[model samples]
Target: MQIKADSVEEYLAKVPEERKGAFARLRKTIIENLPSGFKECINYGMVGYVIPKSIYPDGYHCDPSLPLPFMSIANQKNFLALYHSGIYADEKLLKWFQQEYPKHVKTKLDMGKSCIRFKNVKNIPYELIAALCQKMSPEDFIAIYETNLQKK
Candidate 1:
């Protein structure tokens, strides 16, 4: 079902009962480990953690008005999506995560340009995910994302 949430609370409210706990756990982990200046909001039908327009005035692609999220969490019909802005492209980070969190890696983890998809939240590696989030700085993320955008 399509979510109509305009805020984080509303988004959580719309999540199905079975996935509520998982979503809550993921949300808490993200919030507790999130970098400074980043704010959480619901965008693109997902719960996005972003470095507000003020800090990254240029936004994701230098677009002043955009939120330019660094990561996002969403409960999908068949899976939960962990959208990591540039983690897919950063081999170092990917390798680190894979090595550090073998259990999560063994699960159904789908790697994409900027997203990691899992069948359920229980399969997620909270420690590794948090570490990955903690390792990269906002500026580091912006640079990588911008570089990739230029290459395309």
Candidate 2:
């Protein structure tokens, strides 16, 4: 679902009524456990956590005007989607998350390169997401981004 909102509150308001609670809790869990230096804002039409320009002035490599996006949560048409850049860029982190997912949710993991899809909102596994949020910091993300940048 494409939610055209300018703020996190606005985005939350647009979510389906059935998903409001789960989505809110998911957002809260991320915000609460998110490491220092990442800021929350509406990014790419979702609730995004990013390293602001003040911290990384170069901004996103794709779009210098926008902050470097670390993570984003979207209330998709069929499920809630979490896009974490760290997992997409860091192999160890990706493997760790993949291995840890089964312990948190009984259902088989449904994931993409960077997007983790939660088809059942009740089984969202907020705690695992919290742990994932705490796993990387802004500096760590930037270093990985730069390292990959060099490879490219």
Candidate 3:
């Protein structure tokens, strides 16, 4: 579905009816657990929780215009995509997440370098995801991201 949202509210409004509850819960979880300095918005047709562009003027590596330290949640044709900017690149965090959210890890969720794809929101371990978000400060997140970039 093409999204017409440029902000959080509009993004939520465009979400198909069947996915509203799941997306709403996801948004709430993210907001409740978000670290300081992160901003939420609708970007690239999805719900994006980001470290505002003011913090990292360069944005993400692939798209310099977009902000950094961001994660995006989207409802795809058959799955929910949880895009993590740092998780896929950090071996330590990946291992930690696996141990922290065993059920989700065991589900054989589709994972790219930083994207975790699941068939439905129910498959997501919201508590674990929230905990992960809460554990890191904005600075810590940026540091980790930078460290990973240097290694590449």
Residues 8-112 of candidate 1: C-alpha lDDT, one tens digit per residue: 899999899988998898888888887787788976778998878887777765555777778899987787888986577687887776577666556545667
Best by lDDT: 2
In terms of lDDT, the poorest run of 10 residues in model 3 is 101-110
How do the residues 2-75 of candidate 2 rate in per-residue lDDT, one tens digit apiece?
Answer: 89999888998999999999999999999999999999999999999999999999999999999999999998
Error of 3 at 112 (Å): 2.7
Higher-scoring candidate on lDDT, 1 or 2: 2
By TM-score rank, best first, the candidates go 2, 1, 3
- Candidate 3: C-alpha lDDT: 0.77
Say which candidate scores most in TM-score.
2
Better of 1 and 2 by TM-score: 2
Residue range 1-152, candidate 3, lDDT tens digits: 55677787887877779878888887788889988798888777788888887988878887888888467888777777778765765677777876776764556656788787767666777887898778667777888888878888
Candidate closer to the true structure by TM-score (higher is better), 2 or 3 = 2
Candidate 2 backbone clash number: 0
